[model samples]
Target: MALATSRFLPVLDCPDPRGLAAFYRDLLGWQVTQDSDDWVELSRDGYLALAFQLAPQFVPRAWPAEGVHSHIDVFVDDLDDAEREALRLGALRVDHPPTPQKFRVYRDPAGHHFCLCTT
Candidate 1:
């Protein structure tokens, strides 16, 4: 018999799961399937899933730092266009600018870092 393994769902740790979920909801145009103070789940196309869990001791990842547990990669159609859109949506540009490779790093309003890459 073969063992059944659970699929992977990217889980982000933050002080407020609902707030972070809302940010992602707006950013990715995903609908919130489940939401609460401690946890929130967002879904798109019924497959891609993103979740957030509350961490009272949640210390935001200090990327470009010594060591960090994890980071997220977001793919976009156009790096430059996406960067501008993110800026308009209250995301701060942590890096200088997008390269020809079509990726840029930015931090959300709450300071959670994520990348915007061309798809």
Candidate 2:
């Protein structure tokens, strides 16, 4: 018999799981389904949650060098409005004057790179 393995969640490393989780929770419009001092999960009604794990010795990835191991792309109708909201939520702009592709890159409070785009 095959073992049942049907769930997948991307876990990000951060010094403070609580704060990073809060950032993703707000960014994804998801609610926290689970919480702990060292771990957190943000989930939507029918989607797998994005999880965070505490890593006291975590180092920020070197973008455009080591590049991103993984990055999230959030599609939005109003790129400006979305970029504004991301900035308000502690995301710092990494790439300005987005390309014709209509995507803006940003680094979250914990320094994780993600994109606000129109796709």
Candidate 3:
């Protein structure tokens, strides 16, 4: 009984996809699954995919904004327990969030939104 069983991927719009993809590739040691001037995808087995899309008019959003909205998408067997543990560990739950399926949103200490999903 899960809301979504699809793989989670976070797509980010950037001025330079190749450059940002390179940065994340080196940072995470994830293999570059796809690469191009317009788009780049980096992924590691058992982890979410990181996608960078080139957008000439892309502008960075302020903190707490969704311009780079990304959820690390941690999967677990128990959503309730995981959400509770996340709250206990200092993650602030988002009230009346917007998203499809059964997922919970929370803001990290830095005010970035992420999702806790079960599949």
Cα lDDT for residue 61, candidate 3: 45
Model 3: colliding residue pairs: none
Deviation from native of the Cα of residue 119 in model 1, angstroms = 4.8
Model 1 residue 114 CA deviation (Å) reads 1.2
Measured on C-alpha atoms, candidate 1 has an lDDT of 0.80
Best by lDDT: 2
Clashing pairs in 2: none
lDDT of each residue in 28-47, candidate 2, tens digit only:
78999889999898888957
Provide TM-scores for the models. Answer: 0.83, 0.90, 0.49
**Alpha-carbon deviation at 49 in model 2, angstroms:** 1.1
Which lDDT tens digits does candidate 1 get at residues 56-103? Answer: 787666767745556678888877777777787888878755374677
Cα lDDT, all candidates: 0.80, 0.86, 0.68
Model 2 lDDT vs. the true structure?
0.86
The backbone clash count of each candidate, in order, is: 0, 0, 0
| Residues forming the 10-long window of minimal summed lDDT in candidate 2 | 93-102
Lowest lDDT sum, 10 consecutive residues, model 1, at 61-70
